[model samples]
Target: MTGALFEVTFYLAAPFWALMIVAPRWRWTTRVIGSPWIALPPLLVYLTLAPGDFAELWTVVSRPDLEALRAFLSSADGAAMIWAHLIAFDLFIGRWMYLDARRRGVPHLALAPVLVLTILLSPIGLLAYLLVRAVTPEARRLHDREREDQPAQ
Candidate 1:
């Protein structure tokens, strides 16, 4: 049922989050996270739910009317569709953050909490990660090194 699908959407993404947060140092984590498809399950749910209400959704999106959007979101199906969409994008964002952190040699300790925050509140989590990324010595050093390696104009 729609309710069950709504409830299970987050579960579909939980394992990938577990790998990124709980087993970040594991070699398989990187291997597994390498595929951007990790976000596909919830996205599939979004796809499944979208066509049922495509007309209304298109209207809500295209016109940007506050009352119309509120009405759209008031329905169970609309809420579920939006939830699935959020879960998929959040996982995708989290994956990117994890991979970028690893590449920059940002310590796992610093990133773990950020990933958790991303799960709970992505905008804040993204801000926190950006702040961490900006201040991280390794990230700055890598940026400088990469800049130096570029051929001068």
Candidate 2:
């Protein structure tokens, strides 16, 4: 069951990722991603796997011990739970990146690679998007305009 859940976790997130990366400009893509609840299914899996050993899970997280954390994650259930957590958050982040990039007028060509990177390594993908967003003309112009409108501090 744990193995199956782990496998299914990525499958659940894959369609969303596909929409964001493949058919990014499609009307259906925007409509589907418009709902942030897309992240819920994997989270449900996480919740299901969590109750099995809540005490160990809590202890591993609440304390700073390396070995305890290692032991907890070494278990099948623990690994599966973490995988679901990662999938849910990654999809959420990808959704935000897609919507924000489109709004900022960052071309889909540039955003596609970053979205792909997010699937493999989200922190790095987020960093890359930040750099891209920072340099994008529309995004920078919008930021400057917003700053100008703010009351002087």
Candidate 3:
């Protein structure tokens, strides 16, 4: 169980870091990346609830010699770290999405609240954004045109 949990955390972190690097250059990559902010909570919950053995595994892998890092690995600090990471990641994803929407000509004023909601309550925020995007006739037309322009396999 410890190993499994550690793997899960790594799994959640890996693609996020990768996308952090890749998404800047590739607009299409953003679609595949989903939203790391929204995706991290369940993994954090799993980490918080899993047994102590998971901490031992994580510490061994991380090999954090600093006092702060060690403290963070401890059960009490671990929860704080999880919450911090979640908020930070969510904010980053929300900002990125907001900027992306703006670059795509989606109005900033309309997108700002949705981005804020996503940062505060990820899944629902994402659902609201999706629903709005889907229902907007112009957005739907653009999406359909993009689909039609796809090259044949």
1 versus 3: better TM-score goes to = 1
User: What TM value does model 1 have?
Assistant: 0.95
Clashes of 3: 0
Residue-level lDDT tens digits of model 1 in 1-153: 779989999999999999999999899998999999999999999999999999999999999999999999999989999999999999999999999999998899999999999999999999999999989999989979999999999
User: On TM-score, who's better, 2 or 3?
Assistant: 2
Give TM per candidate.
0.95, 0.95, 0.49
User: What's the CA error at residue 88 for candidate 3, in Å?
Assistant: 2.5
Maximum-TM-score candidate? 2
Per-residue lDDT value at 152 in model 3: 81
Ranking by TM-score: 2, 1, 3
- Which model, 1 or 3, shows the larger lDDT? 1
Judged by whole-model lDDT over C-alpha atoms, candidate 2 comes out at 0.93
Clashes of 2: 0
Q: Please list the C-alpha lDDT of all candidates, in the order they appear.
A: 0.95, 0.93, 0.57
Candidate 3 C-alpha lDDT tens digits along 1-153: 444444455355445444434353466545645554545544564546444445654774478566745655675536444554565566556646654564455554556567657756877777777776776666677778889999988
